[model samples]
Target: MRYLLYALTLLLSSSLLFFVQPMVAKMVTPVLGGSPAVWNTCMVFFQALLLGGYVYAHASTRWLGTRRQSLVHLAVMIVGVLFLPIGFEPPTDATSLENPALWLLGALFLGVGWPFFVISTSAPLLQKWFSTTDHPDAADPYHLYAASNVGSFFGLVAYPFLIEPRIGVQAQTTLWMICYVVLIAAVAGCALALWRSAEPEAAASEASPPAAVLPLSWGRRGRWVLWAFIPSSMMLAVTSFVTTDIAPVPMLWIPPLAIYLLSFVLVFARVEWFRSLPVFTLFPLTLLGLGAMLFVQLGSPLEWVAGIHFLGLLIISLVFHGLMAADRPATRHLTEFFCWMSVGGALGGVFNALLAPLIFDRLLDYPALLVIAALAFPPALYSRRAVQITLLIGAALAGYLVGRDVMIYLGLERSRELATLAAVALSLGIPTVIAFTRARVLTPALLSVPLLISTFYLGQPEGNELHAERSFFAANQVVKTPDGGYHKLYNGTTLHGVQAQDDEFRLVPLSYYYLTGPLGQLFEVLSKRPERHPFAVVGLGTGAIAAYTHRGQEADFFEIDQAIARIARDPRYFTYLEDCPGECEVILGDGRLQLAQMPDERYELIVLDAYSSTAIPVHLLTLEAVEMYLKKLTPDGILAFHISNRHLDLQPPLTRIAGELGLVVRGRDHWVDANDPVYNLYVDGSDWVMMAKNEEAFGAIIDHPSWHEYKPEPRLRVWTDDYANIFDAYILDF
Candidate 1:
């Protein structure tokens, strides 16, 4: 009966802890914008929460009696019941996006705070209870932890592949609530067993062993932390690097996290047979070395390697971690070991996710973590002093040769000078070894190779011309597609804008919905406007806005990317710069930042069509963003937003912004037949949002040749960088 209760408790705790991650994380994307940053940040928060709960359980056993501990947990559980079925309060107004941290905090408080707190504390609390009740027969509580993480792994994978696909968010929430109730009942059963156990106090005291003791010092504890931290943090940094550089898809966060959890499972499993030895031995050597090697080739094929490489690092890191766990001290020291490990984790998150971006332009965290890992794990010592010196010297020479050759291949140093530097580097290793064996000379020398490599990579700034540039988080590249049309590529998302005209290859606007239906009507009205039309194009994609330029007409553009700006404004790439020459001025920076810089500026038409596919620039739709547009536009400026998407509904967010700004917004859903002459040369199927300051502008659009009636859904809240929610808007089927 006790065993059954333990099994039930394990089932309940595992389900609660593991499943909430993906479910709540997906729910928060729309609120925080669907950037990979959100998911990474959520991981940091969850790990911190788990750490806190573990500390709480430790405190519970030390200060409170078992009966009192159960009563206290029961009361907390009751309080947590108030957060049943996991849901957050809907934002009340458009400004909600302005403060996303606050928004995230609120959602966490209401939706899962108490419940997560309870579940997090359960594994440790229950383990302590078992040790006390069963005395000598009680197994190590630490082994159960292996089961706990296994549960977490299942929960993480199950959500995206199963629960989310099978049920909508509402139904998923209901199922979670049912699971929570069952867990509470199981906990009550455990408490009943504790009360009814007939073991005499004296026998229990005599039979139960004293709390497990640590055989290590503070310094050793610190080493354990370094092991745990370097890998976990490196995994996260690699996740950011891969997603930011290779693909910005929503699911990209999964593999890195899954591999991270699986590492824990392999290291902690009761039996060693399940862990693969080859992976433990060979994969680490290759990954640690190759990961650093690839750091030298950022824009080449190395840029395209996905989470699989990250998975390799994870498995290798776990092999070391498993080796460490096998040698872990007594259970009494587990909390101390973990506390320091938590410190390393928190530092890693802060360093990689928060500090790295602010300090450097491109991703530097991954390389830094690699060097740290190498230092943390020095090569095995040789049996004899002379032999040790020889082995060290040989390793040094090989590393130098490999490092220099790799650097030359990556275009860091001139090829002609490679042989000279190679000779110099190799020659120094022998003398360096003699100098190092006599003292600590090799410490700084060994560290310099990676440091120099890191410095070289970081120094090679990504170009911001039409072809190349790197932003705070995303890498931008330009290419001529097979159709002979230019495209702007940000990560994996393609932005199709202007196509070269068939005859002379003149620039033509091929923006998704520009040639048909309601969008055509707006174009006609804007074309016929008496005044010279001034326009603001928020997202500069392949300089497509230049297609609308007319002789003797004045125009200006607002592009957030310096790279995109160069593409649109450079006369050689797009004719708009040549034809309209001096008619427009390009601004650079975040769209909102530049928009605020030009409060007195106005435009007759505004196109907010700049999207890098998988990522939606959330700041562009905030209430503040809407007001900026309203203030910057001529009263008659027609705002056209390209809203084509496979995963999200942007209209509601736009409508909410429009309503807040007192502007009327309409949408044009357009489809084109290539067989039709005028439409054939344009967008095949497009969706565009058309907004006007008031009824007069709306009337003008309606009177245009292609005007069509547009009705927008009311009450949709405006999205801001701080508070956008895409869970409801996600188009899962597509």
Candidate 2:
């Protein structure tokens, strides 16, 4: 009964720790414009707090007697309880897009930092407390760590599937507070067990058996830090890359984190799972496979790409964490062991989440950690001769591939497809052969070269006159097509906007905003109004919408990323903003927040085009946002939303919310004509929703056959500041 109490205490506390991270982050997303950096910043703060908790546990256990230790921890728990019902208080001052990472960090610390810090200490502190108890299982409390991570795993999974879908943030906070109270009771029970045990000296002597092993030296401590650091850094890097490049869907954030926690559980619970032959052999092969995938631009079918990356991350984490678990010190030094591990975790978070974005122009941290992970593995599997031979073969193969790529670029007769296939096969095949041979020394050198070459050469955008820029938000690239006919802007793998370079069509609205598309039709109808009213655009992707502005009208662009705004206005990359006849202004902040600050309705038409990849900013699509947009619009103004997403069908929710607000909604699905001379030059298929205060407000475009009344789904849930379920909006078939 006592052991079960200890288990429950650790489990509940750890669950709360993980659950609060995502829940509170979701609450704060709107304030920061839903940038991926918001999550990364939260990760840094959580890691730092986790390190602080571990240090507290170490100090309390090392200095205090068992009874005193329990009392001290109990006191901290009481203080933590005071911070219950976790919530965020939005900063009174407007959050700047210039340094959103810092702003988000401040918000998280101020809101939930105290409670989170207390809960983070529970796993290590409680396990240390269990060690001093008279219970039968107290001799080996490492199992409790596994139980804690299991709770963390479920906590992450439940947030998206159970909590967010079923309840609002306020209710989730209430439930979390209830759970925290239960944890406090469990913790108090553990303290009583410690107090009821034998006297302090005798209990200490029994709990800590004499050293069967020597004290851990600095070298061994360094190894523990390295082992923990690789997996920690890799987890964040994988999450950032997938969310930014593929989709920024909040649910996508869960898988990488779940894999990370599950790795800890498996390795700590059963080391044999990672010691087997299949696990060892596949680790290097997966590394090579991920490197190959990174080299090529595998557009569309994101599932396949996401799957391979997830698998690679899981395998790598298991190997490194398994090694750390295998080398763990005796129970007497457990708290110190965990303290060093937490230090590594905090360092990894800083490097990947905070430092990488500031120093590197791209996400070099992901591939960089892959190289470090390869090096961290033990080299005992290889003889000296085998190591030399593998390095020789790997070097030659890398040279040949680099030469082949250079030749292809120089217009050699070699087929590009065949050369690429050959390179990928050689990269994967070499690592597979080395792993089967059990040549461990060759593993690091052989695997790293391919990853480096892939990241530096093959992974880069292929074109002449290419320019790349990185901000706290995302990495942006402007590239001219190979034929020199067009210039394109890319946010990771997703194309943001494009422009024809030819003089005849240079100023025309191209890509999704072409004159024949729904956006174009929206402006055409707006042009019919007698007054030249002010226009507002949420996202300034190459400023393509600026082309629709007439001579007398004024346009204001609300762009969250300053780098993207600069790219759109610069003539070298695009000329939409510069060429527009109307007066143009750029507001650098979250569109909804900026619009809310406006004193009155002034804009004739407001366009919501701010999406990161296919992931719609859930905050911007909520009912409250729609209300804010309406408030900033003229009486008959229309709200246009670019809802063309590859992964989600947002129309149902938009229609449902507008209907409940008593607004008129219309939609158009514009498809491109292949036979049209300007097919790729200007228009692409797009889906857009236009809503207004009344049906008569859409008079100019109402009679057009292209426009259709948007029907609301009676069963669909309306999204708002307090409640939203993106899973309901997800297109499963896609």
Candidate 3:
């Protein structure tokens, strides 16, 4: 009965400990882009604190002994409860946003530090406590630690599915407060158990189990670091590939993180069934075979391709974590072992979040990290002749296909069909041989050969093509097409530029939207006032806005994507340069940053057609950002915000910004007619919000039904770069 109380205490303590992780993380999600980096950074801080807690636990067992340990831990619990309600208090200044990691770490330390430290150390400390108690055959505390993680896994899984969807963020905060109080009271009960079951130590047996020992030497720690680092880094790399290369969706962070956490379940679970030899024996074969497949880029039909890669990474991470878990020591050394592992995890977070973006112009870290992880986790079966033979053949075939694809991409051959077929065959053939032979060592090398080749092929055209293609925040592939003697530039998912194919198309902006809507109407009006008609475009989708410029107007294009600018201005991609002469200049960097950098400038018409809910960078809609836009515009400048969003009703925010800026606003929705040929005469609709400095400008565009008096809702808050509350904005019904 006493041991069950200890067991229940450990379970409840751990449940409270891990439940706060996802709850606090979800609270911070709206402030940060819902990127995996948010979770990774949180893990770094959690692990760092965890290491501290473990060291304290290990030392208490060695020096202070069990009785004193209980007093100290219970005292820390009492102190920790003072900072209750699991949520961060916003920092006092804006500079804190510059390095949110340090701020978050400090905040986490203050808010839950004592409680977490108390609870974290308890896994080991209580186990030692259980061993000393008069209860015969105290089950291994190591198994309870596993039980702790099982509770943790439940917490992680529950947040997104059950808790987050049903409970409001505030409700989550309130619930955590109630849980913490109950958990603390439960711990107090355990402290009573320790005091009541007291024994004058079988003094010989109670003297701390000879200071827990480490199995590995310094050299072995290096190997553990390597083992830990590769899988940790690969987790981030897989997310990059899935999110960027496959599908650039907002909620894409969930799958990769879930996969990464599942590794812990495999590694730490108390169940030993399927936890041993088969994993190690088959590990080499699957590593090389799957590793190679992951590296290869089979283009298009990608709806499920990303899923396949995610699943492959899941298998790899699970395999590695299982191997590590199998080798882990008894309860006494568990904390120390995890402490060293934490170092590797922290390094992985830094490399992916901070270093990779600045170091590589492209997502180079994805394939590179995969290759590294493969090498770090090499299987023990590399000495077989049969495996060696299969690997060599796979490598040779991949080499030939890669060579052929490179030649075609380089214009060495114009036959796209032959090269395409050859590339497909190579991608399939190599994986089959590696799978058949079970050669793990050859898997990484084989996979890497194709991936490296694909990267070069993709990079070569991107590097060399100036006019139609560029990669900045996302890959912008622009293709030129001729329509009725007009030249048009198409961005990956949308058409960006439309002009005459020859000098004829140059003066005529040709798309359905550009030729008929408020933008098209604004162009017609600007033709009469060139000297005073400077126009600023927020996004440089295809440099198409430049095509709308007339003889005397000066235009500056505010483009956030470097890749889009490179391809949009390239003569090969479009005739933006050849057709629209000195009327335009491209300013590269984030639109908000560049505008903030600019001198007091006024545009006759400023386009706020930034993305909204879809791929809309939310930073542009913040009160702070809109204020910057108002500063850069003329007194009568028409602020046209593209409010055409599927999920977000941005008109409210735009209206709020207009009210704050003391301007009047109107909205217009434009579209194309299926049978219109004159194009200019096509009926148009747009949810364009036009804000101005006076009543007359606001009244001028108010007749449209979409137009409404600007009103800000009490619950409808504006988002800023430093913070955004997307949980409030989640349209679950929609």
Best by TM-score: 2
TM-score for every candidate vs. truth? 0.64, 0.91, 0.66
- Whole-model lDDT per candidate: 0.60, 0.78, 0.59
Tens-place lDDT per residue, model 2, 1-734, is: 87788788778888888998889889888877656677777888999999999999899888995679888877887887777777776655444446777877877887888888888998888888877766666766777898899999989888988888889988999999888888888888888877886533444424432231656899989988998898888989988888777666667777888899998888777446674445666666667667656655453477887887889999988887877776777777888989999988889889887888877777677777877876777776324444445444554555566577777666633345444555666545664565476545565776576676656653345466468877877788898987888999987666788988887888888888988678877787777778868989998898988888889788989887888988888898898888888888888787887878766678988999975353467899999889889998999889998887767778889999999899998899877778987674646778888999987778767778888888888987888888999877765433
Error of 2 at 164 (Å): 0.9
Using TM-score, rank the candidates from best to worst: 2, 3, 1
Report the Cα lDDT for residue 570, model 2: 87
lDDT of 3 by residue, 562-678 (tens): 555666666655666456754788876456666666666567777765643124455677778877887787766667776654444566655665666666665566655656665
Candidate 1 structure lDDT: 0.60
| Candidate achieving higher TM-score, 1 or 2 | 2
TM-score of 1: 0.64
Which is the better candidate, 1 or 2, if ranked by lDDT? 2
State candidate 2's TM-score. 0.91
